[model samples]
Target: MPDGYSRSSRRLSILQCVLFCALTGGLAASGIVYDYSRTQELARQRLEHTTDLIAQWIIGAFHASDYLLRDLSGLVDTEILQHPHPDPQAQRRLTERLIEKKDSLPHAFLVGAFDRNCIVTHTNAIVGFDASERSYCRALRDDPSAEVFVTPAYVNNLDRINVTQARRLESEMGDFRGMVAIGVDLDFFSAWLDRIDVGRAGSVTIVDSAGLLLARKPMLPEELGQRVVEPRFLEAFASEDEFSAIAGPSPIDGVVRLFGIRQVPDLPFVVVVGEASRELFSDWFWRAVVSTGMIVLLWLLSVLFLRNHLLLVRQRSQLVRVAHFDPLTGIFNRRHFEHLADLAFKHARRAAVPLSLLLLDLDHFKPINDQHGHATGDRALLAFVEASLSVLRETDLFSRWGGDEFVILIEGDEADARILAQRLRAAWARIELRNDQGAPLSLTASIGIAGTHPAVPGELDSLEKLLAQADAALYREKQANR
Candidate 1:
C-alpha cells in the first residue's frame, strides 16, 4: 500500500524473473550438449559394426583363396616341373588340372605353378610369364620356412591391380621349389563395396599390413598401391585391438570423418570404414537449433507475463491509495476516517475506555479566498494539515472532513483531547503561508471537543450524537472568542 512496499515488490519480481530465465537457459544448454554426445556415441557404434562386417567378408574371401592355393600346390610335382625341357605330355596334364582348379574358385583370376627359377612352368592362362621379381615368388625361393605368403597390391601384366596369395612348393626331400599362386582381382572388393551404402561422403578402404592401399570404394585411382601415411591410420594399424574407432581428417580429401578400423583375421590386411561427420550429425544440428529457439521463446514469454503482473499490482496499489487518502494533503479522507472512527468507538465501548473527537474549522477561510484568491486559501489548508500532523501522535486518526475543515479521533477522554487540541493550535499558528503576490498570510482554526465517558450513561451513544455535541461546543467557543 505504501510506495516503498510497492517498489520492493517490483524489485523482488524482477529478481525472480532473472533467476528463472537463467535456470531455464542453463538447462537447455546442458540438454543440447548431452544430445550431441549421444549422437556421436551412436555413430561410433554404427561404424564399428560396419567395419566388422567388411572384415568378415574379406576374411572369407582370403580363406577361400588360401584353400585353393594350398590344394593346387599339393597336385603339382615341383621336381618334375623344375626340369628345363620336361615331357610335353606331363606339362599338358598339369595345365589342364590348373585350369580345372582355377575355374572352381570364383575370385581367383590366374592360377599357376612356378619352378625353382621363379619361372612359370604350367598355367591356367598364358604361359612363359616370369615371376622372378614378384615378392611372393622371391619369398618362397629365398626362405624354405615360408609356407604361405600374401603379397601387397601391384599392377599386373594386364594393367589391373591384383593381390596374390601363394603356398610354397617343396620336393619330397624338403627342398624349396618355388610356389603355386593365385591372383585376386582388387575389383572384386570394389564391386561388392559399391553395392553397400556408407552415406554421401563416406568411404571403405582395404590396406595391406605394410600400409599399402589395396582397394577403396568411392575410389581414387591415383591412391591405389600407394602407402597410407596418416598418423591415425598408422596408430590403428599398430594397435592390438582387433577393431577400433578413431576420428580425423582424411589425408586424401581433407574431409573430417569418424573411422572404424579392423584387421582381417589371419591375413595381412586391414579394413577401414569412414562416415562423414557433417552427414552423420545433420539431424542433431537442426534439433539443437529448434530446441534453443523454443527455450528462448518460453523465457521471453515468462518475462513478459511477469512484467505485466507487476504493472497490474502497481496500478491496484495506486487505486487503493486514491480511494482511501486525500490527494492534496496525503492523509486519510472523510469516508475512511468515518470507518476507522466506528471501529474505534466499538472497541472503546467494549473495553470501557474513553474515546474523544476533535473537529477543526479554519476561521475566516472564505474572506481569505475572496481577498487573495482560492490558490492562497488552498495553500493555507495544506500548511495547516502539515502543522497538525507534526503535533498529532501516530495513534491518532486525522482526516480532511471538508474544504477548510478537518477532524481527528483520539483514544483518550475530552481532557486529554483538549491537550492535543491546544498543541495543534500552537503548531498551526507558527505556519508561514503566502499568496501568489508574495504577500504574507495568517491562518487560524477553531476546535470542538466531544467524547464518550465510561462513567456517563448514553451521553454519546453514536458517532452522530458525538459530532452534534462537538459542533455546538465549537460555536460557543467561536462566540466567546469574538
Candidate 2:
C-alpha cells in the first residue's frame, strides 16, 4: 500500500516468521541435549575428583601407621629387648614406646614372638604375638621374604577386632622372626569420614585384599569381616578404567548400590569403596526432566505471544497509515499535515527553539484540472508528492496539506533545509502527467519551508504562526513568477 511493492513481499515475510518459529523446536531440543551432556561430564569429573581426595587420604592414613611402626623398631631392638632373649626390663621399655605412639596412631598395640618359654599367660606379653597357632602368624613366621605381613580381619581370640596392618621382626637373613602386629581400630576412621560429608546415602568403605571390610561410615557392625568381592562383585567392580558402576542388589544388604572403587597401592590389602544409592540418580534426573518441561512450555508461550504481537503491530501500522494518509497520494492528508505541524511546534517549545513552517502550493494546478481533466490533476498531485519526498531526509517531514498544496517541516540544519527546498523546486519543474482526455500537463510547485533555527529561542507562539510566515513567502514567490 505504501511504495507500490508486489504481493510476493508480504507473503515472504509471513512465511519467514513461520519458518523461524518452527526452528525453535529444534533449538529447544538442542538445549536439552546440551544440558544433559554437561550434567554427565560434570558428574564424571566430580566423581573422579572425590575418588582422588579419598584415595590420598587413605594412603596418608596407611603411611601414618608405618611411621608409628618405625619408632617401635628403634625401641624394641635398641632400648628394650636384651638381644636374642626376652627380659622384664625389655617388656617395660616396649610398653613405654607403644604408649607414646598410642595418641598419634589409631592402631597402638604390640605383638611379639610367642616362644614356648614366653607363651605363659602373664610373664611378658609381646605386642605382635597374640596367637602363634593362627595362619596369620604362620604367614609371618614361615614366609622368609615376608618381612611385613598385614593380616586379613579374623575372629580374634581377643574380642574379634579387625587389623589393617602388621609388621614382622626377622633377622637380616630374611628369617621368619616373631611378628609385631597392631589391630588398627576402625573407630579412628569415624572422625575423618564424618568430616568429609559425601551425602546421606554416600559412604566410604575400605576393605583388605582378602575382601574383609576394614572401615566404613554408617558402618554395619554385623558386616565387619564380611567379604565385598562376590558372585555379584563384577557388577560393582565394572572395569579397571571404570572407577564406578551401579552394582546389582546385594544378596547380603538387599539394596542396590552404585559403587566407586579406588585401588590403594600403599596399603597391601586395601580397596577404597565409595557407595551410593540408585535412588540418588532418579532424584536428580527427575529434576532435570521437570525443568526441561517447564522451559519448553515457556518457549511455546513466548512464540505465541510474539506472533500475536507482530500481527498487532502490522494492524496498528495499517490503521494509522489509512487514518492519516490520502488514498490517491501516499502522503499525509490535510488533517495529519496539521497534526505533524502541531507536533513540531510542541517539540520546539519544549526544546526552547525558534519555529519555521513551509507550505507549498503548485502554480497553475486547477488550470490543468480544467484544460486536460481532473485525472491529469490527480496524476500531477501524485507526481508532486513523489518529487517532494525524493528530496526529503528522515529528519524532514513531508505531507500533502490539501488539493495541490503540500507542507514540509525541517529541523536542526538550516543549510540542509535550503538545499532540500532548492532540490524540490527543480524536481517539480521536471514533473509531467497526462489528463483523462490525453492532453499533456507540465508543473512547478510554489515552495515553502518551516522549522526552528538553533540560534533564536522561543520566538513563535504557535506552529500556525510559522505556517503563516511560510504562506506569505509562498504568495510572494508565486506572484513574482506570474
Candidate 3:
C-alpha cells in the first residue's frame, strides 16, 4: 500500500476506536441512570405498601376501641349516672362490667362512663376522675350530633401518652346524657411497629388529622403529642390524594427521608412510613461504584489493546516495505521486480502482444565513486533513478538489478522500447551531481534492449530467458562504449 493510504487507514482505525469507546461509555451511563430511577421507584412502591398496611392496622385498632365504647355505653344505667353521687351497689356493679369489657380489648388503657358534667361516673381504672377538660369530652358537648369522637394524643392522668375514642350517650328524648370513652395506649402500636423491619434509620409514625404525632417507632418522646410542622408532610396531608409519597428533611429529627403517607380511611389519622435517603439508596450506591469501575476498566483495556494492534500493523507495514523495495532508491528490488515481470510476460504471451526488456549499466560509475566518496556515488545513483522514473510510464517495471546496474520491463515491442531508452538516456544526461568540492559531475548509462513478439515465440519464452538476452546485449553495448 502507498504510505498515504496506510496513514489514512491508521487514522480511521483510531477514530473508530474512539467512537466505540464513547458509545460504550454512553450506554453505561444510561444503564446507571435507569438503575437509579428504578431503585427510587421500587422504594416508593415498598413504602406505599408498608404505609397501607400500617394504616389498616391503625383503622382496626380504632374500630376495636369504637366498638367497645359503644357496647359499654348501652350497658351503663342512665338513672345511676344522672345523680352527682349514685347508689353504691349499682355503681359497683357498673365498675365490674367496665373492667370486664376493658380486659377484652388488649390495647385499651381505660374504659369508663361519664355523666353530663363530664364527671367519671363508672370506671375500669381511677374513680371520680374528672374528664371535662379533655378534647373528646368538649367535642361531644359542642357537637351534640357527633356520635363518635377521636381526640389527639395527650398525656393521661397516668402520665402515659394516649388517644381517646368516645361514643356520645343520648337519652330517650334525644337530649345529651353523657359519653362512654376508651383510652388507647400509644405503646400498643409502638410495640408492634418495633417488630417491623424498617431500615437502620427508618421509622413508622401515626399522626392525627391535626398533625399531632400520636405514636412512633424509633420514638422521639419529646415529639409525641406535638404537632409535626414539616412542609412536605403538611402538603401531602392537605392534598386530595388519600395516599402519597414525598421526600424531604424531617422537621422533628432533621434526617432526610422518603415518606409514604396514607390517611387512615374514615379515621382522623394518617400513617407515615419513612425510609432514610441514605439507607434507601445504600445498595444502589455500591452497585453504581462497582459498575462504573468495571466500565472504566474495560474501556482502558480496549484502548490499550487497540494501541498494541495499531503498533503491530505499523511495524508489519514497515517490514513489507523493507522486503519489497530498494532501501537506497525507494524502487522495487530485483526479487520483487522479477516476480511482477514474470506475471506480465505470461499475460503478454497469452494475448499475442509484445513485451520488451531493457538492461542499463552506469558507465564510469567506479571512477566517480573512487574520486568523490561513496556518498556522492549514492547521490548519483538516486539522481539516475529519479531521472528514469520521470521518463517511464506507471505500467513499466523499473528496478535496481545490482550495483551500477538497473532493469526495466516495458509493455511494448523492441521499437517502443528503443524510444523509451533514448528518453531515459536524455533524462540521465540532464542530471547534475556535485562532489564535496562543489564540482559538477555528469552521469551516463549504456542501455541494451531485447524484446519478444507473439509472432516469434521461440525468441523469449520466459523471464529468465529474456533477462539473459538483455544481459548479453548490455555487455556488448558496454564493450563498444569502452
Instruction: Give the best candidate by TM-score.
Output: 3
True-structure lDDT of candidate 2: 0.61
Candidate 2 C-alpha lDDT tens digits along 1-482: 33323234445556765666557666766766777567555545555666667667766776777666556544454222333436756565656556666556654443333332123111123333336566556765676666555555666555656563555665666554444445556564444566565566666666665666766766787876677767445333333443554344543455555555655544434434434555446555776687668767776776676667657656766776788887788777778877776777677767865544567888888788887778767878888888778777766667777777888776654565567778887887777766676666777777665555534555555667767777877888888888
| Candidate 3 residue-wise lDDT at 306 | 84
Q: Rate the local accuracy (lDDT) of all candidates.
A: 0.83, 0.61, 0.85
Best by lDDT: 3
Give me the displacement of residue 183 in model 3, in angstroms.
Answer: 4.5
lDDT per residue for candidate 1 within 363-419, as digits (tens), equals: 999989999888788788889999999989888999999887888888888999999
Residue 350, candidate 2: C-alpha displacement in angstroms: 63
TM-score of each: 0.74, 0.47, 0.76
After aligning candidate 3 to the native by TM-score, how far in Å is the CA of 328 from where it should be? 1.9
By TM-score, how accurate is candidate 3?
0.76
lDDT of 3 at 23: 89
RMSD after Cα superposition, model 1: 5.2
Model 2 residue runs over 4 Å out of place are 1-27, 77-104, 107-110, 113-146, 229-242, 245-258, 268-291, 298-482
Better of 1 and 3 by lDDT: 3
**What is the Å distance of residue 165 in model 3 from its true position?**
2.3
Per-residue alpha-carbon lDDT of candidate 3 for residues 102-162, written as tens digits (9 for 90 to 100):
8888878788888887888887667678888888888897787799998767778888777
